[model samples]
Target: MRRSFKISFLLIVMMICVLSGKCRAGDRFIRNSAFKGDRQIIVTFAGPVSDVWANDISNFTVNEKPDPDIMLEIEDSTLSLDKTSLVFTFKDPLNREVPHCLTLKQIIADGRSQGTATVTLRKNYLAHLFSVFLGAVLIQNFVFVKYLGLCVFLGVSQKKSTAVGMGITFTIVIVFASMLSWFLYRFVLKPYHLDFLQVIVFIGLVSLTVQGIDTVLRKVNPALFKSFGVYLVLVISSCIILAVPLMLAANDYDMFESLMLSLGAGVGFLLALFLMASVRERLELANVPTPFRGMPIAFIITGLFALSFMGFSGMSLF
Candidate 1:
């Protein structure tokens, strides 16, 4: 037992070191020996930071004097986790170069003043966007991978028509949830340093957005709302819808990539829903065990659908 404990302790220590190394590897630091003051310094980050913090943490001391012209700030954090890249902006906006360490130091000093730290910027655009899209659709898919919102996935997938409608609704809700969450995170919570309130704020946002969407749909098209609103309730407070955006916002994906991720996730949800619905409808006519009539068969069908989506691996449509 003692030997086992020692082994476990060593493993924990090694893991901690590895994690700490990764965390510190992103620190924005520049040594004076590497300084080339003549050239414009471009720094890109792979994490989160604020403009005020960037200005504060990023310092410039040229010949031991504060270098005003050397300061740099975030151009944007919108990045694709799959296929994204950053284009460095120079004093001449048209001129671009690879980001280096010096610029990062300037950003860190800037962020320090603003009470923020280095935020990671996307290094490769195309790869990151593609990675994000694929990850959402496959690795962390809302349906098969994360198994979130299964209630709606199974409940509304009874007919192809209903499935499509639910899919469309799901997409819209997810996108809206992402947008609202991003806004609340950046504007409301972060400002007050109440970052822990993310969960509460997001839940509030989702409920309010769903309610608003439901009200609008009822006012505009009562029949559509009547038919799909039931399913909407099932999805109304889903964490998946809000979680994706919160994650994207935290990681600082650009607008387009965020949209793409939401879209891909919606698609994955639709795909699962449609497949399950088709299987369940067919099962209704087939001889199913009495014990496994409704939910049991539906669950079995979902399992099969999940298995099938797994086959989509190693295939890239985009």
Candidate 2:
């Protein structure tokens, strides 16, 4: 029994490795390939290539995906002086979010060897995910740039402790709910032609997630839970939480992308809340005009924060 169990475990692990795309079995002639910037491919060969074969445009083909049908137009194909590398420049920028396939045909290398092979090219997958994460956190911040989640942004930002606590809780809820929404959209609704029911379905998922969190938090740490107060209930309908799921569905983001985006949005909202709390805390001490003491001054300060956050727009990670 033990031996059988071990064998089963090993089999499962191997299957996972293959499914995760870690198993690349390309020919040795194709030493390596990588995406250069976003529009070019840098392929290193096992040996120096013949200049004649390397320059022919027909010798190389680029496709958007593994499917042979969706080919990209190559504007130029140049061989490095050493002839061990080929640089393929495309007419348009490659989509960083999707993997591209490159095929080499009748390629003579080292003045003798000739072969054909295909390689999968993509921006470092983890790097792409990081770019997506950072873009969501800073570049596309919901609170400051998209004008989202202001209700909680204003309601809980009065005290640093409150703001920070709400931020943490909101992060947990948003990530969990977004993933659940993605699963349902990708598997259930999309397959069944029920896309129209997404909004109503997501609302239920959010409410369910918030309810579960509310119950668990009420038990594990009542202080933090009580600190949440009515705002915990408000998360069910918070524009920030709801928007993440809708964005995931609309953009057709994969599981990792959905997670990064939801997580980034949560963290951005937290930053917004903390900053407001800090400023508001200082304002409580400083002398202020009677008319603009509370929410009024807070709004003006928030506008300034939004303006500062606009500086992040220049960052284009994708």
Candidate 3:
């Protein structure tokens, strides 16, 4: 009877200690951690850590998330003034496009040795892709921003009917040309070391895309084909069309990035045509002075448009 009573008392004592947070010797943990930039990581602990353990580079591990194979070499580590955070500097910049993991092992905080804890610094692929698309469309527009495709912007924008037709036709041609150029550059030319042939090859691809589009339109809609007679050929020489493929190759953009940029450029060009056409149509009905009439007024308006687009140069949607 005494033995049973003693065992029950000991069990009650243990439960009380556990419930009061006295059973565990170490409960200090990580509050959160994040990357400050491409070359630094900052970790904040739930409680103050001992400088000896927190500043020791050997007690921490930093690497790309979900893949321990790529380890980052720490150039140096510093504990915060309050000892609640540790900042780790890397020897080189991390891939800003990838998430990284930081492991805090042998943590000594709150006068006790705590277990290992890990924090993941996340990467948002969707946000990055969105920023790229927005950059091409508004921040780096091919027509107003880079001054390319002005020939088409001014030529077709005289009439709303022709401007709409040209915009649609240009979009289809450029998207197709850019995609095909990427495939050839990645698979064919890159393998054979035919780098020098890029300019000639890209031009040929543009010509081919234009030809295919020409045939389809001629068959399905003869009136539309006649309306686009010379302008369709002019698209073959437009700077924006050729520049996109060359930029994709130079930047080594992946398939999705290439597609987004190409599409964004097309939409941006369409926007320019539409805006210019609308204003030009209004100008046709308005009374105007003779000297500042046709092309002079057009150039002035384009200049104002360029200045307006400059405001979006550093804008980020993500």
Task: Give the candidate number with the greatest TM-score.
Answer: 2
Clashing pairs in 3: none
C-alpha lDDT values of all predictions: 0.60, 0.85, 0.81
lDDT by residue for model 2 (1-318), tens: 896899688657645733575555467788899888868889998888899988889888888774579789999999999889889899999876677888888678656646678788777778888988898888889999999888778888999988888888888899989988987897799999999999999999999999988887888888877777556776765698999999999988777778899999989988889999999999889998999988889899999999999998867665
Could you give candidate 1's per-residue lDDT for residues 211-246 as a string of tens digits? 888998999899988877876787774557766866
Instruction: Indicate the residue-level lDDT of 300 in model 2.
Output: 96
TM-score of 2: 0.80
Q: Can you rank all candidates by lDDT, best first?
A: 2, 3, 1
TM-score for each model: 0.57, 0.80, 0.66
TM-score of 1: 0.57
Q: Of the candidates numbered 2 and 3, which has the greater TM-score value? A: 2
| Clashes within 3 Å, all models in order | 56, 0, 0
Model 3 local distance difference test score: 0.81
Off by over 4 Å in 1: 1-127, 221-227, 249-252, 312-318
